[model samples]
Target: MQERGALLEVVVLHPRDVPGADEGGADRLFLVNDIESGGLSPEPGTVSRLCRETEIPVRVMLRLNDGLTTTGGELSRLVGLAEDYLSVGAEGLAFGFLDSDLEIDVEVCGYLADRLPGVPWTFHRAIDSALETDRAWRQVRHLPGVDAVLSAGSVRGLDAGCDELVERAAADPEVARLLMAGGGLRGEHVPWLARAGVRQFHVGSTVRPGGSWTKAYVDAAHVRSWRMLVDDAVDHELARRTTPYT
Candidate 1:
């Protein structure tokens, strides 16, 4: 079982990975398709089957094409797709939007949030690619139903962005609370992130055997190792919080 107060989310590209992820202690599954395109939306039938099979909460991706901008008939199509995913039992959604200027496209995001009133969502890595980091964070903080903001602090992922993530979390309480640290996440990053107050973690190819999204399946043992690493890190952070100063 995963430790309380921390979440370990694993990506599921196919239904076959479901049992191993669930059995290996994933708290939730980020269901997506076409990993090569950085994860576009999955078909509703796929979502339905995975939702039916896995007890873990499933957050389906809502992007139709590569990049963050959506407009015209594409927006309409996405709204309908959102409904389809919900109808099939998706517990949450993962999406992000940016204008041509590379800023948070609040209008588009708000429109979708309005249509799906109570559904929780995550603002994905588009925040890292925004024109300004602080401005994007400010915009997303108030968006309705956005329970988390997935970021690696830079577009380049953890190796380049880890320090920035730690600093941001320490400086801003809301960022810390809503931040779901991910993108090239590794075991060493877990302890630092946990200590900095990140309670949620997302893993993609990391949980797969040989870390190959196409060649290898998600391995139960690999997932379990991540579960243990995150759980232990969170446990230690909690202990440190309650420990008396010398």
Candidate 2:
């Protein structure tokens, strides 16, 4: 499977790190307030700050809590919050949900996307948690307003699910617009992941100085190195696709 140029998303834990993320040449900023629960939406103030200060795209996660079961009043509240974030100028939204059976809640997810009208959305990491990965994509990939799916391919992570990703990418290059490879993705892994059909690379922990574990800062220098590697790999892949084969 040949790879296309991927959009790089760098996670920013703090609003203050926004500039550093941009300086590192990030294509998008994953503004997060809570990482332990996957991630949560940033404050409206933070969203406003990023909007005012940065030129790059910024997406705020709409996760209300840590768990996957969002429903009833909680779901309603999330809807209102989505409007608030959009009103305050978030470039896009990211959120996830699952039914009691641990599947993609298409009815619920469809409503969420429909409410936003024209805004771009990401179906978050919930897809990785789904029991039926194939079924999940079949339903949600083409859902209105969903521009991407932030997944590691399977619950285990990119490396474990590379084969599934490779297959999916081959079946539908348009699936979720992009099968963004996140979770444990790094520079060295890019070439193989690309060959496995993954086109987009996302790094949260990797964007930090000590790989988002030993440190809590978005190291611009570290990001620059990753940026170089990602751009080079994407370019090389595109070149490969264009070269005439024997």
Candidate 3:
């Protein structure tokens, strides 16, 4: 496996968004439910199918709601679902835990992390919802067994403060990192983010139907388009960086 902050790696949203998702150049698959609320949580069967079939590593993210804060029962349910997914071949689990105050619940996250062995775990974007983003980063960086945080850095906009996020991750050694730059990311912005020190990225629109409320969802050609965009961006960067200057 490549190091955490390698260079411009893509993580597709849901399996459905990218039908032939496994074949794409994405480094990871964040399995979720494509509900009206924005996040995607797949059924056990769906996760199993992707894990059993896909060659790429599969990571399943469980959310308590459209935003942060999860209940004990909900956390348990996620753990159970994670077990099921793991048994069927899932490679990682993506989730976040927050206390009643809505801050990162290191204790609770540690509990869930303990339950999951071998499979890597992502703190998810719940970090972006904290009352304070800087503090959230500090707390999550200390969480045990956390593989990375799938965050856009600031809740205001994924692209707005990417430099801050990248700098924070780069400075923290205790925190293994993956700056999952998401939201408003396109073929054009891919290079900008790469140069900004963001190595990992998340893209969904290219795989799913665009618009907040499509009412009528259809083809997910966006996934293929996104894959192409990221692939091209990586190829372009590789060539540009490797060229010999005369």
Candidate 4:
């Protein structure tokens, strides 16, 4: 398989890194905190600072409820915070809400569209929590302003039957173009995903030596190493496709 355009994207899962972050060696920066238990709503300062200093476009993902459910007022507050993030410099936001049956709560998403400016928003893997993956996908993608849906495709993970994820991404060009493959993703598995026509990627462990709470900071070495592999893969994939054979 051959790569087309720039398909690789790196998601920054560390909070401390956000304050002093530079676009020194990344094609894109996904701003978030606490990858261990999904992610939390970013601190106001972290989001604001990244927007101020970085040239790289910022993708903000807010994990509502810190791993629980959010009430209407809570969602409203989150929207306010997201608006502040966009005003500062964020180019997009990632989030998801589930109904009782685990399907995407379209009502909540609609409220978000009303709250934030019309920037890009990705429905995070919370979609995978749906009891019905395909139905959940259908409902989420149809939400207004939802530009992308991030999923591992199946409950298993991105590595399993990834072809389905690529197909879903290619199915609706109008509603969704960014097909982010995540969950148990690593450098070694990128090629397989690329071959399956996946463009956007989400990775963390490969970027860190060992994620530790005691570190009190993002590991620069891990960031460089993970980014290098991603860039190399993007280059190799693109070269394979665009290089004309004599």
Count clashes in each candidate, considering only residues at least 3 apart in sequence or on different chains: 0, 0, 9, 0
- State the lDDT of candidate 3 residue by residue for 31-61, as single tens digits: 7775446464568888877676566678886
- Report the C-alpha displacement of residue 85, candidate 2, in angstroms: 1.4
Instruction: Give the per-residue lDDT of model 2 (tens digit) for 143-208.
Output: 888887888787778778766776777677676246787877756667766654566778888777
Candidate of highest TM-score: 1
Q: lDDT of candidate 3? A: 0.64
User: Candidate 2, TM-score vs. the true structure?
Assistant: 0.91
Cand. 4 Cα-lDDT: 0.67
Candidate 3 structure, TM-score to reference: 0.77
Q: Which has the higher lDDT value, candidate number 1 or candidate number 3?
A: 1
Error of 3 at 218 (Å): 10
Model 1 scores worst on lDDT over the 10 consecutive residues at 1-10
RMSD of each: 2.2, 2.4, 3.9, 3.7
Kindly report which residue stretches of model 1 are placed more than 4 angstroms away from their true locations once superposed. 1-4
TM-score of model 4 (CA atoms): 0.79
For 1-246, candidate 1 gives per-residue lDDT tens digits of 332478999999988889889889999999989988878999999999989988889999999998789987888998999999999889999999999999999999999999999999999899999999999999999999999999999889998998999899988878988999999998899898888888999999989888899888788899999999999999999888888999
Error of 1 at 185 (Å): 0.4
Worst 10 residues of 4 by lDDT: 15-24
Residue range 1-246, candidate 4, lDDT tens digits: 333443334566544554322432555677777666677777878888766666777788766565535687788788788878888888888888887767778887778876765677878887777878778767876787876677787668766746666566556543224567777676666665564445666654445446543454445566566566656766776677778999
lDDT of each: 0.91, 0.77, 0.64, 0.67
Better of 1 and 2 by TM-score: 1
State the local distance difference test value for candidate 2: 0.77
